[model samples]
Target: MLRIKLKWFHSLRLQLFVLFFLVSAIPFMFFASLTTGRIEAYFLEDSKAEWMRQANLVVSQIIQTNNYLKEGTNYTIFTNKIRELSQSEEVNARIIVVDPLGYVVADSSRIDLNTTLLNTQIFNALNKKNSSERYEKAGNFIMSTAVSIIDKEDNDKVLGAVLLSASINDIYKLLEDMESQIYFLSLIASLVIGLLSFFSSSIITRPIKTLMKVVQRVTNGQLDQKVKLNGKGEMAELANAFNHMTEQLQLVDQSRQEFVSDVSHELKTPLSSIKVLTESLMCEEDVPVEMYKEFFYDINSEVDRLNVIITDLLLLVKLDRTEIMLNINETNIKHLIANILKRLSPLARKKDIEMIYEANKEIYAEVDEVKLTLAISNIIENGIKYTPEGGQVKVKLQSDMQDVFIEVEDTGIGIAKEEQGRIFERFYRTDKTRSRDTGGTGLGLSITYRTIIMHTGSIQVESEEGIGSTFVIQIPIKHV
Candidate 1:
């Protein structure tokens, strides 16, 4: 249990939660402390101001009596007056009257009477026209105020001074209470912030944790594993991107498996035939010359088939590369198509298929000549191969403002609708036995598809089984 808690404490979520909590709570706590201190200071100043006003009033009254100016005069009347003024619930203070020489004559809190008070406020109030105030800090804030008692007839003449000293005990007590309240509020705020941060961290990290699990599964070769998340933000976009990547990985894995199966099947067929023919020759004790020649020809034919398959496989590999450069040039499309049909005329004649070419005008387009010729020849050859004896194979070329189109139509044993979509895949054949007889490597259409794609072109087929098939190729007029 302790280990689990420690692990959790070490996790990024906890760290983020704590960081957020601190970010939210620290400033408020600091501001609260700052405000409390200001309030305390303001209260102390206000108390000092109040006492200064009170001292002025007491000084005004004392100056009117003129008792301090006379020698051997009793201070009973002045003392009684000071005592009466001091008896107030709101004012917790000591009031003292000092002569010009700084002797403490009458004190409301009478303990320090007859002693000379030595302080900046007392000395300044006695000498200067303005009252002076000062504060001292000990266990609690203490405030002092002093005012000069002047002769009424002559304002410049300083008779004596009245000093008031007050302990800001009430203000300090109020501040102590406020501090306690602030501390309580801060505690509550911290707890609330921590809880909110913890929940928020979970909300943010949930998707990341889910993605981590998905990544782990993918690392374990589970290519189909995907991150399922929903929202409208960066994290949601990230999840969608991850799912897209997984889909691509799954497709690549599937393609790899299919390719392995196809290659093995293609290689095994020729190898098995060659092995059987060679074994037959080896087992024959006294083979005739004609029989040896036939067996050797058969073996040579299988080797040639193997060579075609391997060559096609290598070409497919080269075409699959991302960095293969095209030898692009402006070539007359009419001339190109004419040459392809001329080259394949022998094959068409052997099959007794009528070859036809139709175009309204000569077309010119940017293309890789060798590859484009190969692609066109593959489609036309397939048409001738698939068509019955004396069947019609038509080739049409047309062009628009931006693109040129070529259509190869054949009256052939057409492909099944279900199998049409996969015709362009490597080593995919509609009729494997017939394809072998016709010397089809199964890579021809695949090469044609990839070559057109590399040139930013598209191809589509329209076929009905037992009727006919048409392959339409579209290539851009200008290479970009």
Candidate 2:
């Protein structure tokens, strides 16, 4: 039972319920107790006043029979009068009359006649010049009152004193009944609040529980799972964020799978060529010298292709890291583009394509020379490769106060509009068959995109399926 209680104590629902109950009920209980005490004091004071009035009437009667009281009368007439007063249903009290000597002359209960009254209040009343009343409390909710009895003709003559002892059990009973009602009402209020708290807690926690379940499914590799929440506060915002995170995770997972497939396919092609070349050489023993040289040259070319693929993969991994560092230098943009075009002009000449360069005399900027060169080279090389014979490959460089713009345009087989957005994605090709025939690894544009982005630059493509493509590259004048 203790263990179960401890377990319940750990629950948020129970804690919330208990907290709400205390917040609501404790003040009510405190006020109820305060009200009860005030009422008890009021009733006690009122009861004392009523008993004092009754004692006054008895004192008046004693004075009416003052001659008998002074002559040592037995108080028979006084006893009869008090007995009638005491028997009334409204008063629950004992009446006592004390003589001048502080001795009990009469008691309404009729059991202590002639007993010496040593009470301090009775002695104090015997000395008072006029009628006086004082009260004290005892066991059984009893109140004792002492009132001085005086002669009506000479109010200064103290003949005797009256003592009224009253039991207030009925008043106490009323207080007890009221306290019980308060306790009962408090119980009902706590129950109602607890019920409301339980439902309110449920409303708050339902979305959290659903999110936990969806997270569990995602942890188990269910990337497609998502949570739907109808709530209209923080919970709804949290659900939207959670769904967005899951969507990004799904995209990352899909991209990873495609990366693995592309990597394997890229590696397999060159490896198969090397294998076939070696197998041919092995089959033909003592082959011709020129045939051997040609086969060895072919094998060496495939190895170089394999090396290029590995080098690009390594460069991409380095670029993906958060700690990538660039060697910044102030280089003339026009000179850089001219150098790239000059290096690639031989490849263009092989296809009978014309290379054209247009730029300002000098446009210097702080940039990573190697990375920017690779990015620009890939675009111009693609332009030269894809353009038909006698086509023009144009390289134009322009600059503003803040940035330098490089444009590479070619009269080549342009890309479709739909494929332009994903052309920068790794291992994506507009025409895979043509790309492969032209020895394009499909990673050049991806590398170009990453390099340009690292320099805080932007690249855009404008193309139609049959028209030529224009590649625009924008580089910042200074690193931010």
Cα lDDT computed for each candidate against the true fold? 0.84, 0.83
User: Candidate 1, residues 1-480: lDDT per residue as tens digits?
Assistant: 111222333386778867877886788689789989898778767876788787787777776664654342757877877777677664446888888888888889889889988677778888865553555576656667788888777887887788877776777788899998997788678878877888778778777777777777777788888778888899899989988998988878887898899899989999999999989989989999999999889889999999999999999899999999999999999999999999999998997889999988989999999999999999999999889999999999999999999999999999999999989988777777888888888899999999999999999999998899999999999997
After best superposition, candidate 2 residue 280: deviation in angstroms? Answer: 1.7
TM-score for model 2? 0.63
Give the residue spans of candidate 1 off by over 4 A. Answer: 1-13, 26-184, 196-214, 222-251, 361-363
Task: Give the clashing pairs for model 2.
Answer: none
- Which 10-residue span in candidate 1 carries the lowest summed lDDT? 1-10
Predicted structure with the largest TM-score when compared to the true one? 1
TM-score of each: 0.66, 0.63
Badly placed stretches (over 4 Å) of model 2 are 1-12, 18-191, 230-237
Model 1 pairs whose backbones collide: none
| Residue 188 lDDT in candidate 2 | 77
Best by lDDT: 1
